[model samples]
Target: MIRTLTEKEIEISGEKKIYGTLARPASAYTDEKFPAVLMISGSGPLDRNGNGPKGKYQLNVYKELAEYITKLGFITFRYDKRGTGKSEGDWISTGMWDLVDDAELAFKFLQNHPQVDRDKIIVAGHSEGTIIGTALSERQELNGLMLLSGGVGNLHEFTTYQRMLTYQELKNSKGIKGLLMRLLINEEKAETKTQKQTKKIIESNKDVYKILFFFKQPAKWIREHFAYNPRVGLKKVTYPVIAIHGDKDGLVDPSLLEELSSLVKGPSETHIIKDMEHGFRFQYEQKSMVNVKKMLKVLPSRPLNPDSLGVIESWLTKYFKADVSSDIKENA
Candidate 1:
């Protein structure tokens, strides 16, 4: 039998109105409630469809994942971050906890859906969402969690490690750019400047901070995230968890998958796919944040890595098969 999907544009009321799309199997099952997945996007001014501002970034990772999982008989909800898309508030001023609140509200929206199985709801987060979902799991009892491109460290520690890797790559560059960088940039001074900037942000009381007297950043958000330790909440997560990272994911260390999985008190699994980047697409070239903009320009054209999707399918089936209704399972 061919499976069809029913999608609806919905809103969840909270401190601010949250806009999102919910997709579910269209099969008739009046007395049955299907398992559901709430998707939390990575850090960015991203929309419900996972596109960035004015189509500058069009990696539709969450949208594709939601559609794929919905086809597998699960209802999936992906919402816009505050101040982005049709959602309310200022993204630049929104703190990390605010994102968590929005996610919780999205979860409650799923739980309250007539066709959703309250006990079978799962939260799947990518990159930044991984930590947010972990934090949410501490607040809500989720059936399962899927952490993509994220591991078990605070943002501060992770960013410092990423800087080190980028520095090493730049230090080894083989041309004029390398010569100029080495001549003009002192690693020790760079580190000191970064430390000073971080200290300023942490001590600031402003919601937004101006850098270079022009560029604005979400100071409160950075402050909150830098201090957040996912280990505390992850250690309390007794629910099944599956973490997937790409071997080429430059933003988050893929090797941390082992530590992340081990922290979960419940059954857990991890996968590190080759050539896959943080965006879930395959990138055969050297992956670096320095070339992120250039890479993102081509990422939307590339399809998601088959192995990553397969792992998600396999893990969900293994741990949450009972959550799917009989008719939906039959179709699968």
Candidate 2:
């Protein structure tokens, strides 16, 4: 039988007042506790529902994950990072450590909750969140850790790879203009160009230049994130870890799953979802600019990769012993 699940708006105080959703199985006259999972989003200005900026896209990925896990008899919590969604704080000014601190606060809040089985808390992080989750596992004692489409190599190298791929896509679509621009701002030769020379060339297209340089590339958070290597922290975690990556993930390399699994001293397992993309969506043609544009326009209607959730459920059931036989439903 499917049981009821209840979700409540929760506030966690940190450097600022952080807002989140706490979900649990609803039971009629019992003070029973259950295992809990904390969900952390990837990167950028994503809201609690995993929706990016208005015109970008709305995936609702994290929210779906929370609801799905809650149905499996585990209380789940997910929050908006500082400066995004309902949370209070400045988003752009926050660095890597700031995010880690916020996650730690959320973990403590879940651990202390009366309806949570403190010993059975699991930290599930996606993309950039995987780094934070792995780092937290090293510092805290936890029952399990889950990494979804997370990176395991050097941040700088990964950033470069992503940059090149994007540039290549643009070149393929924009033809000569894109090729010329990319050649001029070659990341490999970025160090050789003086500030004045770089500024002069970028001034020709200030909008794109600012986005690539000031906003996305050279920001404080980017620098700090670039310095972090998940492998370093994964080496210290002694708890069971499940790392899942999509075979078609464009942002992170699939090989990271092997690197991550090899570092974990505890029992570790890796899964590669065939034809799944970075956000656990059906694999879309990223190489073609026309396909990319069409996919972005219809993203809200796109269904998630069905296999993704099943994999997570089965892994949790086998490793974390999360009860999947329950049928409780709770309203938020």
Candidate 3:
């Protein structure tokens, strides 16, 4: 029988009031508690639904995952970033440490929830969330961890890698826009500019940096992320861990999945799904940062890659059994 799902608004108190949503199956035993997954979103100003500022990024990744996991009988909690949605604080000024604090509070909230199985709670972090989750695991004990679209590298290393790839894309462009880009951009010069900007962001004490006196960049966030290494915390994880990445992902290197698997001391597995992008959508064209951004324009109309979901489901069931049916153990 298909299970019915339920959802409700949840508020978590941190430096400011953090707004979120909790999802679970409707049917339950009198004394039964369900395994839970506390979702941490990737970098930037995102909400519980995994959307970005001004509805520009309407990628409903977390919302889709919550419903999918709830059907398998696990309660999931996802919250808005401080300063975005209904949460308190200014997102532009919120640093990486600030996000980690909010995630820690979310974890504690799950631990005390009446219907949640405290011992079976898992953290499912996506992209930047992977960094926050790994750091949190080093400080607290969790049943398992699911790292999605994240690597075992510092923000600086990843950004450098991304810049190289985006430059390659610009070099291989075939259209008039590509011609203009090729003529206007010098990779060597761009790298120099990037290095200078990185140095400025690292040295500056300001929360935000204004470029051309109009565009604002999160200085604190960049500095903190550049300084923290996800691998350091991954080394301390003794619980079951699963890392997933899309081979077609343009934002993050998929090879990082191997490094993630090797760093964790406990039982772990890694999977790289084909045709899946960073946003969890299947990409039909060549995967590039430019194409990824273009695809985001229609993210709402796309479906989450089934292959990626299958990998996650298989891994979750293999180690942490959920309330799937009478035959499966509720907590394993």
Could you say which candidate leads in lDDT? 1
- Candidate 3 local Cα displacement, residue 51, angstroms: 1.1
lDDT of 3 by residue, 1-332 (tens): 12577789998876899999998777546466889999999988889999988867888899998888877778899999998889999999999998888999999999998888888999999998888998888777888999888858767777787888998888778889788878988889999998897788779999998777888999999999988988888898888998888877887876677676678889988888888888788877778886766787865687899998898888777777775552243333
> Which sections of candidate 3 miss by over 4 Å?
28-30, 175-185, 324-332
Local error of candidate 1 at residue 92 (angstroms): 0.5
- In angstroms, how far off is 17's CA in candidate 2? 0.9
TM-score: the better of candidates 2 and 3: 3
Ranking according to TM-score, highest score first: 1, 3, 2
lDDT per residue, candidate 1, 204-316, as tens digits?
99999998899897898999998889988889988889889888788986666768766889988888899999989988988687777889888899999999989988877
- Best candidate according to TM-score: 1
Global lDDT of each candidate: 0.85, 0.74, 0.84
**Distance (Å) between predicted and true CA of 71, model 2?**
0.5
How far in Å is the alpha carbon of 293 misplaced in model 1? 0.6
Estimate the Cα RMSD of every predicted model relative to the unseen true structure.
Answer: 2.0, 5.3, 2.8
Cα-lDDT of candidate 2? 0.74
Angstrom error at residue 49, model 3: 0.6
TM-score of each: 0.95, 0.83, 0.93
Ranking, lDDT, top scorer first: 1, 3, 2
Worst 10 residues of 2 by lDDT: 200-209
